[model samples]
Target: MAQTDLVPAARAPVLAAERLAVDGQYLTFSLQGEIFGLEILRVREIIGYTQPTEIPLMPAFVHGVINLRGSVVPVIDLAQRLGRGATELKARTCIVIVEVDAADSAQPMGILVDAVDSVLDIGADAIEPAPAFGSGMRAQFIRGMARREQGFIVLLEVGHVFALDELAALARGVETAEAQA
Candidate 1:
């Protein structure tokens, strides 16, 4: 008589992995004692504070351009642009290079920041919507606010900040004057 094969033992149950709400990451930094962040994908590189070659007739916020490996990129003072007083450059000061596309062009621009903190992995649930209150800076430039142990980091809409349409118009006017000369 052929012996019947023993029935296989039941396998242990496997639990499904819990999905986290937070997905994307942000680069957190400080400006005027307030925290701020930008999506890591938008940030190209970070460099220490350096003297920029001032461009004449440009807006105060436009700190001029710098030669980064043969590429000329404009630098904007985020503090001044947000209506905050000029920030004194400290050892921690840095320039965060951001790539922004314009309506008519696709060139990237660089923005000078006070200091960089760390890269934070924030979930969607961790981000809080910006308040409706009229903050000094335009609401359009805000992506959302992220809360951290230190405080809330104002996440910036880099695309809106570096659009440069207004500045491009002003630059066109100067170009026209030069052409007429």
Candidate 2:
């Protein structure tokens, strides 16, 4: 089956509150030797790392954009965005495409990770609230932390991680500064 086929049709839109409270599968991946997960429902597909077309004046974390079956989608460097330093692409590197809620719409975005791991079923009982400190990343970016026999999986809140509104505002500020200059 095609990667697109894995995506569910006619599925109910996931709400922010319900995203972390539900028990379901998570698509885990490795970044800088740490395990990170994203709600599987939000994931559309995964593809091998493809060099993206560079965009000028975008945030350093914004790697660039790619043409996805005709759609120009922005790709983010997950490690850099998390302040863990930029990811050094390897043979195992992959881009996980996900749909993030933005302004009453779902936008397709790609996140570059070190490698794609298995999809694990993480129960609600095994989840804990994001820590107030020492998570290494912004608290809002974390949906929760899940305990596994291997270790803790940092569950990411996709909407917060790829917040289009916040990014747009930041981009606007950059543009305004450039114009003033």
What are the runs in model 2 whose C-alpha is more than 4 Å off? 1-19, 177-181
| lDDT (tens digit, per residue) of candidate 2 on 18-103 | 55677999999999999999999999999998999998777778899999999999999999889879999899999999998877
Clash list (residue pairs), candidate 1:
22-123, 22-124
Q: How many angstroms is residue 101 displaced in model 1 relative to the true structure, after the best TM-score fit?
A: 1.2
Worst 10 residues of 1 by lDDT: 11-20
TM-score, cand. 1 vs. native: 0.78
User: How do all models score by TM-score?
Assistant: 0.78, 0.86
Highest-scoring model, TM-score? 2
lDDT of each: 0.76, 0.88
Model 1, position 146, has a per-residue lDDT of 75
Q: What is the lDDT of residue 81 in candidate 2?
A: 87
